[model samples]
Target: MPVVGIIAEYNPLHNGHAHHLEHVRKLAADEGIVCVLSSNFVQRGEPALLSKWARTEMALAAGADLVLELPSAFACSSAEYFASGAVSILNSLGIIDCLSFGSEEGDIDVLKTAADILAFEDDDFREILKSELDKGLSFAVSRQNALKTVLTGKSGQNIEKAAEAIDQPNNILGIEYIKAIKRFNSNIEPVTIMRKGQGYKSLDRTSPFSSATAIRHHIRELPDLRAISNDPFLKSNMPEACLNILIKETESGRHPIFPEYYSDIILHSFRNMPAENIASLPYMEEGLENRLKRAAIESVSVDEMVSKVVTSRYPASRIKRIMFSMLTGMTAEFLDELKSNGYAQYIRVLGFNDTGRSLLSQMRKKASLPIIVKPAGYKKLDTLAKKLFEHEIRSTDAYVLGYRSPGQRIGGQEYTSSPIISVR
Candidate 1:
């Protein structure tokens, strides 16, 4: 049987996610379900509604055979790096045969064609891209123009159809996934599952199925999700109720689920760091720093800060990635080191299932690095893992304060929850 890999952040393990998993398994039924997950921070600039460990339990319970953590560096990165990191780990494991993902359109061939063109930008394409960008067109529009100029020369009708198809949000990410697979030259086959329910970033509060952003906002306001979703994992949240669940959990000396520990640090960094320094943050391109600096002084909530800095041309998502990089200290230099390694040498086991034990045993025979399922304390780890884990805990601790007065020093590797779960 082949093993398939799914790279995801089940931020809250909602119903749409459950559908994605079911569809992926059906597409690659014979393959073992391996998922590389985001730990604390997500690609979006906000904290996860649930912790990685919690998310892991949710996924394994859903259907995944095994789950591993996508190191924090890659977890909170832009779409390009997020795809790179998750794809690299699956490639390194050398076990996956098919890679499956959810897309607005399940047209894998179009995505692959787009990926092929993106992999190598020609002179014509580059010139068109530059001209459009100089004219203040968004990168998406710039890319669409470049693609059209190149493809329309030969297949005008085909190019028109492809242009309309490729411009959607999910399709863009799917292309990135294909690009990452080619970049690694991995043996994994690629497939796309069509998305069901509310559209991406849809603000339709009326739909039981909403975007993760909407659900998160709803939780903050209502906390009670059972009335909202038929999702079992979310429905189980009782007594805790909506946003108060997070609030009460933090007050009870629990981790705030995401790397919430960095709120003050992020605030301080924004407050003190110069506009020049902010520009150095990852994905901070084309004078976006001035807006960020201004927002730092004027905005209060993280959401408010992002909104203040976002421009139609620059886009909020890119700005969020930049601030997230700053919050986590994932400097470009650190990214360079990770790039050199290709796959981070550490498999900081985020969460797993019944098959995880078998997979771990299999990995030991061929793997080059240590896969630590449980991180006990600071005393035992090497420099790199220790530093990463500590910062994660610090972010967790700092985040909990919004709800409680839990004052305790988190050691180098002192995670309140078990770092890994051999979920058998």
Candidate 2:
């Protein structure tokens, strides 16, 4: 059977996600819809509102035919690497005929053009970009402006849709996807589905809801979800269980699960390691290692550390992702080694259903790579995918530990939350 792959973070399987899945299903009626998902930690460098298992089950239930986890390394990266990682994973799956992504622009031709031009950055564009960066514009903003000027100046391609061109989140990511698709030269077709509402970071709560950012903020304010449940925006798709988990954490006076896991690790890495070593931290770049080293030593909270290092040049999001890697014991070298393996060799199921199982069975003969029915089942992948699974498992453990009364056994909660979800 033909399969279409969607690279997503489902983050919480909200209404927007359901809409995308539904659209892909309708568009690719002749094929199965496979979603390559980021587990636990998102590209934003925040712990997912729910565990991967929960998100996987939600995706399968929502409309995804197969849910495969995108390893954490690629999951928490910049637009380009994120796209490359997701694209390569889909390419490895062999049966994916197309990749459908949500974007502000549905004009695949324009996205394709932008990707093509972006791929071949000539001297003129490079100079303009560097100059803009030198002026303190964010790398993203600089690139966008540089591309626009170079296009207008050299190629006579005036992008009249100026508002549509800049680093509006979904489109930025979509451009990356298109670039990745072109770079790989894989058989998989690239398609961008237009987003219907406020853009990715907009706090607007109109209709089918704003981005995950808005949802997260809204959820954090409520004493409980009852008030928001009545709104068209909150349809119970946001995972009440997950928020309650956070509530438990707050009530128990425990540190947020992530801080609890990595505080010592990060503190140790900061105090003992050289600033140069921070360069090796996954997602570290552009001399931010020294900035991070100083911040890590002085900043008391994650937010403080983030604030200390954030600049227009270094987005707070990127800093969070970089620090997340340090906290998790992940390094750029390790992820680079993993990336060199190139494509996902195992299709470990985060969740599945009748259609998903059917698709899995159909792909067995056609898939170029092994579909890992269970990561825990295989002794070998259990090692190679160890960091990937451990992050997922630890994130879950951290969540469950949040539920425990203060001073409860940490070890007990770890395995309790790590139970492999049975795919029936």
Q: Estimate the TM-score of every prediction.
A: 0.83, 0.82
RMSD of 1: 4.4
Worst 10 residues of 1 by lDDT: 237-246
What candidate 2 gets wrong by more than 4 Å, as runs, is 154-164, 224-233, 236-273, 285-287, 343-345, 381-424
For candidate 2, what is the lDDT? 0.67
lDDT by residue (124-220, candidate 1, tens digit) is: 7899899988887778778887887777756544445566656777777788888888877777888887776677777556655566655565555
Off by over 4 Å in 1: 27-31, 156-161, 205-208, 223-265, 368-370, 376-424
Local distance difference test, candidate 1? 0.67
TM-score of 2: 0.82
What number of backbone clashes does candidate 2 have, counting pairs of residues 3 or more apart or in separate chains? 0
- Among the numbered candidates, top TM-score falls to 1
